[model samples]
Target: MRNSRPIILFPLLCFLSSTISILCEPNTLVCNEKEKHALLRFKKALSDPGNRLSSWSVNQDCCRWEAVRCNNVTGRVVELHLGNPYDGFDLEFYRKFKLGGEISPALLELEFLSYLNLSWNDFGGIPIPSFLGSMGSLRYLDLSYAGFGGLVPHQLGNLSTLRHLDLGDNSGLLYVENLGWISHLAFLKYLGMNGVDLHREVHWLESVSMLPSLSELHLSECELDSNMTSSLGTISEVHFTALSKLKVLWISGTSLSFHVNSSIPTSGSGRGFLSGIVDTAPNWFWKFASYIVWIDLSNNQISGDLSQVVLKNTFIDLSSNCFSGRLPRLSPNVRILNIAKFILGTDFPFHVQKMNGRSKLEVLDVGLCGA
Candidate 1:
C-alpha cells in the first residue's frame, strides 16, 4: 500500500512543477490585458484617415503594434510615438502617414507611460486634452505642429517630472495666457513655444528664467512684448546672478522694441571717449556670449548701436534690423554669420578679416549691408 501511494504522488508533483515553470517563462509574457483594452479604446476615439493604426487590431499583441512600446519584464505600455514620421523632406510619405484626429484621454490608462510624441499631424484644430497633466510619470512630450487651438492648459504644470516640452509651430491657434505654470517644471531642459502668442504674458521672460535646467528656448515669432529690452535689463539684475545655462536662444521675428539709454556705448571704444557715443559700458547681449551656442535676433525693429553687444556664438544672425555702428568681432567658434540689411561702418571689412584667420567662419552673408 505504501509503495503504490508514493508512485502516484511522484507523478502528480512532477506535472505541477512543469506547469509552473511554463507559466513563468519569458515567451509566455504578453501585454497586460487591461492596457491592451485601453489601447483599443484609444484607437476607437481617433479618426485615422490614413489607417496608421491598422496593426492595432485584436489579432496581434499590443506590444507589437505600431507606435507602442512595452516594458519587457512587466509588459506595461511605456511609450507611444504616434507622430507623422514622414514629415521630413519626403512629400509623398508625409501625405500617406499623417493622422488627423483628436487625442483621446484614454491614454491615462497607461500609468507607466514616460514618452509621448504626436507631432506633425492634423488634429482638426482641437484643444489639447487637459487630462495629460495627471500623467505623473511622463518625461518627454511633444505636440508640435499638431494643429491644436485655444489656450495652453495650466494643468500641464502638474507634470513635475517632465524634462522636455514642445508645443510649437501650431500656426496661430495655440497660445498661453500666462507662463506662471512653467516655473513648476524644475527639470525642464528644452522648451519650444515658437509661433505661439505671448503678447499678453508680460512675465514671459522672468517665468522662463526660473527653469534652472533650461538649456534651449525657442520663442521665435511669438508676438513678445515691446518692452523686451527693459525687461531684460531688470531680469539681468535679478536672475543673471542665478545665471542661464541656455545654449540655443531664438527670439527672431518678434517685434522687440530696442530703447536703451544713451549712457551705453554705440561706437567702438579704444579707451578714448567720443562726443557722440558712450564709452565702455557693459551690454546685456555680451553677458550671453559665454553660455549661448546659437543666437537669432533677426527681422525686428531693433534700433540701437550694433557694436553695443558682443556675442560669442557658433551661429549668429542679426539680419534685417536697424542696427548701426561697428560690428562686434566674431568668436573663434563662429561658423555662420548673417548681418544683412544693416548700416555697417567703413571698417566692416576689418572685422571680416579678423574672423577669417582665427574662426571657422564660413557662410558670411553681408548682403544689403551697404558695406
Candidate 2:
C-alpha cells in the first residue's frame, strides 16, 4: 500500500495523455500541396451548378473534399469519385449531379491517383483524355454513362496494371476502331464496354483472347456481328486454354452465332460434333467455363439445350432466346434461372418436376416457355 496509489495515478495519467493526443488530432489529414492545386484547377474547369463541390476550397484540406480520398499516411490523393452514384431509385439523378466541363489535364499532377470514377457526369461529348493512359499506377478507371463521345483513346490500353475498366453505357457514342491495343492490358481482369459500338470490330474476339487474366467481360448491346461461322468450324478443336480465368461472360443483344441444342458439324479432317454454344460446345470453351459464376445470353438468337455445359453455382439468364429442346439441366448450385420466353420443347410435367427439385434456385423465371 505504500506506493500502489502513486503507481495507479501514474498509469491513469499516461492513459489520459494518450487519449488527449488522439482526440486533438486533426479531423482530416493535410493533403499534398500539388494535388490540392490540381483539384482546385479541376474544380475551376467544371460547371457545378448544384454546388456539389462546395466542400472543395483552399480553407479546407483537399482530403476532406467531396468525392476525394487521400492516403492518410502519405497525404497523397488516391481516389477521385465524382458524379452521381447510380443507386437506381432516380435514373435522372445523373442529370442533377452531372458535372459538365472540360476534364482538366491538371489531374495528371496526382501521381498516386489509383481510382478515378467520373461516371454519370457530362463531359460535353469530348474524347477521353489520352494523358490518363500515362497514369501507370491506376487500378480502377470508370467513365461509364458520362456522355463521352468519339474514338476511345487507344492509349488506354497502356494501363497494364488496370484491374477494372468500365466505359459502358455512353448512349452509343464511344467507339473503338482498333482493339489490338487492348492486348497490352495483360493484368486486366474485368471489362465492361456495354452499349459501345463494336459492330465494325471484326477482330474483337481475337484481341480479347490475348488477355489471359480476364475474369469478367461484358459486351452486351455492342452490335457485334455473328461472323464466327467460318471460325466455328475450326474453333471446336482449337484449345482456347488461355481463357482459363474467365468467370463471367455477358454477350446479350450481340449478333453472335450461337448453336443451341443442335450439334455443330466441323469440317476439319479430324471432325467431331460441337454440343452447344461457344460457352459449352467447344472443348476449350467448356473447360475454361468451369469456374463461371455468371452468364447472360438473353435476348439473342441462341437455340441451345440447358444441359451438359452450363456452369454450376451460376446466375444463368437464357431468356428471350430460341433455346428449345429440354429444359437445361440446372446445376446443383444454380441460384437463379431466367428462362422466360425460352421455347423449351419439353413436357410441362417433366419440367416442373426438375424445377421443383432444385432447392438452391432462389429465383426461377420460366414464364412463357411453351412447355
Candidate 3:
C-alpha cells in the first residue's frame, strides 16, 4: 500500500540501462571504419554471383556479413570467402580474376587471421609472396585447386605457425624443391600435395619426425618410384613413429606375402604378401588408425591382407594391385569397397565371416583370385 509503484519501476529502469550498455559496447562484433572500407573494396573487386554478396553492403557490420568469419573472442574479421560467379561470364569467372591483379594487402591487415582457404579460384601468374608467409598468426593455408604458378617462395617455411597446408592441384607446385625444410613445420596437422614433385629422399619424411603434433597426411597421385617405395622403411620407424597424434593414413606400405587359400590370379603382379602391415610401421599409425574409417590404395603397388585389422567406418580400396587376404567382416557403415586384383595366394588358413553390428555397406566386389 506504501508506494509500491517506486519499487517495481526501479528494477525496470535498471534492466533497461543494462540492455542499452550491451548494445553500445565498444567491444561488440561490429566492424571498425577501416574494416568496413576494406570490405567495400573487396566487394568492388569481386564479380558477385546470384547477388550473394549483395548483403555485403556498407551499412552492414562486416563481421556479420556473408562468407566472412571473425575471431569470436576478439570480434575481428579473419576469413573472407568469395567464389561463386557473376550473372554473366564464364563459369570460371573467379579463375580469370586471379590471372592478373593487385592483391589488396588490406586483408593481411587483419591481426587475428589464421585460416585462409582460397580454392577453385583462377589465380594465374600470381606468386605466393614472402609477406604472405609472415602472417605470424596463420595456422591453416589452403591455396589449392588454383592456377597460380612459380616457385613456392621459401618464405612459406617461415610460417612456423602453419598446421594444415594444401598446395594441391596447382600447376607449378612442382617448381619448389629442397622441401626437407618444410618438414620443419612442428605444428602441422595436415599436409596434402597431389601432382607435386616430392618423392622418396626421406629427408622430408625425416622432417616429419620433427613434427610430433601432426595428425593427417594425404600424398595422392605422387607416382612413387623405387626410392619412394623404399622410404616406407623409415616412415613408421622414424617420423611416423613420432606422430603420436596421427589419426588417418592413406599410404602403400612395403610389399609382403599373403596367405592365399586358392590359386593366385594371373592378372595380379603376385608381389603382395597380404600381410596387413598398416599397423606395423609405426605404433602411432596403428594407434590412431583404430579410429579411422576411410582408406584408399586403389591404383598402386600394394599387396597385403585386408581383413587382419578391425577398421571401423572404413571404405577400403585395394583394387588394381595384388591383395591376397580373405575379406574380413566389415562394419555395415562402410560404403565403398573393391578387391578386384585381390588374391590370398592359394590358401586362406583363417576364417572369413561377416562382422555383426549396426553397419551400412555400399559396395562389395571380390575378383581376380582364381578368376
Candidate 4:
C-alpha cells in the first residue's frame, strides 16, 4: 500500500509541473484583422505573375506572409518589402519576376508602417502615386529603377521623417520641375536621383543643400550643366557650408564645369568625389582631400597642374582630362591610379620607380600620356 501511494504522488507531481510550464509560457499575438484586410486589398491591386505573395492567403496569419513584417508586440504590419529579388543586369530575369499594376491606397491603413521598398520592379511607366507623400510614418522609401514616369509628386516633401529616398535609374522617365518640396526633408540622409532629368530645376542645389543630414548625394546623368555648377558655386558657398555631414558625392557625366572660388567653405568629412567636370580644383577641396578615399574627375575638360596637389586618396582616376606637367606623387595607400590620356611629363618612369616599393599599388594606367 505504501509503494502504490508513492507511485501515485510521483505521477501527480509530473502532471502539475507540466501544467505550470504551459501556463508560464507567453501568448503569441495574431495579426490585427484590420491591417490584414488592408494588406489583402493592397495585394489585390498588384499583378504578381511570379506568385511571390503565395504565402499571403486568407487562412494563414498575415504576419507570416512573404514581404510583410508585423510588430511582435502590437501585431501591426510595419514593413512591406516588395522589391524585386534579382540583383543582376539580366533584363529577362527582371521581366519575368517584376511586380506590376497600381499600388493600392489601402496601404494608408498601415498606420505604423515605416519601411517600404518597391525598387527594381516594372510599374509600366505610371506616375508615382501622389498619395505616398501622405504616409507620414514612412522612414525608408525606395522606388529606384521601378519604371516610374512623369513628374515626381512634390507632396513627398511631407515625409519629414524620411531618412533614405532613392528614385534613381528610372530610364530617364522621372523628372521634377521644382525641388522646393525637398527642402522639407531635413532628416534625409541619402538622396539618389541618378538618371532622372533635372534640367528644369534651376534651384535644385539650393533645395538639396538644405538637407544638413545628407551623407550621400547621387545626381549622375541628370542633364545638369554649367548653369547648375554656377548655381552650386553660389548656393554651396552659403548653404553647403552647413552640410558638414556630407560624405559621398556623385555628379558624373553631367557636363558640369566647376569653377572653384576662395569663398567656398571647407566643410564635410568627404570620402568620394566623382565630379566629371571641373575647371580648377578648389582650394577647399585640397584642404579636405586628405580625408577623401576616392576621387574621380575623369573624361572632363579639366586642365590643371596636379603636380603641386598631394593626393592621399586610395583610388584616383583623373583620366581623359587636359591635366599637364609632372605626375602627382602617389600616396602609399594608393591602390588604383589612372591618369590616362593626359600629359604627365616624360618622368613617368621615375614616378613608377618611386611607387615600386608601395605594395598596395595594383593598377597603374598612364596610357597615351606621353609617358
**Best lDDT among the predictions, by candidate number:** 4
Please identify model 3 stretches exceeding 4 Å from their true place: 1-15, 18-30, 35-66, 70-75, 83-104, 171-176, 181-184, 227-234, 251-291, 305-310, 328-335, 341-360, 367-371
Ranking of models by TM-score: 2, 1, 4, 3
Report clashes for each candidate as comma-separated counts: 0, 5, 25, 0
Q: Quote the lDDT for 216 in model 1.
A: 86
Say which prediction, candidate 2 or candidate 3, comes out ahead on TM-score. 2
| lDDT head-to-head 1 vs 2, winner | 1
> Lowest summed-lDDT stretch of 10 residues in model 4?
262-271
lDDT of 4 by residue, 214-253 (tens): 8878887787765445555532345556667766666655
Which 10 successive residues of model 1 have the least lDDT summed?
271-280
Please list the residue runs of candidate 4 whose C-alpha ends up more than 4 Å from where it truly belongs after superposition. Answer: 1-27, 227-236, 260-278, 294-299, 315-317, 327-330, 338-359, 365-371
**Candidate 3 TM-score to native:** 0.68
User: Per-residue CA lDDT of candidate 2, range 231-269, in tens?
Assistant: 433333232456678888887876445343333344321
* 295-363: candidate 1 lDDT, tens digit per residue: 887765454554545567889987866555667766678888898876433453324435434668778
Q: Give the total clashing residue pairs for model 2.
A: 5
RMSD of each: 7.7, 6.2, 7.0, 6.9
Score candidate 4 by lDDT: 0.77
Off by over 4 Å in 2: 1-24, 86-92, 227-240, 258-290, 306-310, 343-358
lDDT of 3 by residue, 110-224 (tens): 6667877666665555766557776778887887766556666677777888988887667534445556667667788887766554553335566655777767666555444
Question: What TM-score would each prediction reach against the true structure?
Answer: 0.81, 0.81, 0.68, 0.79
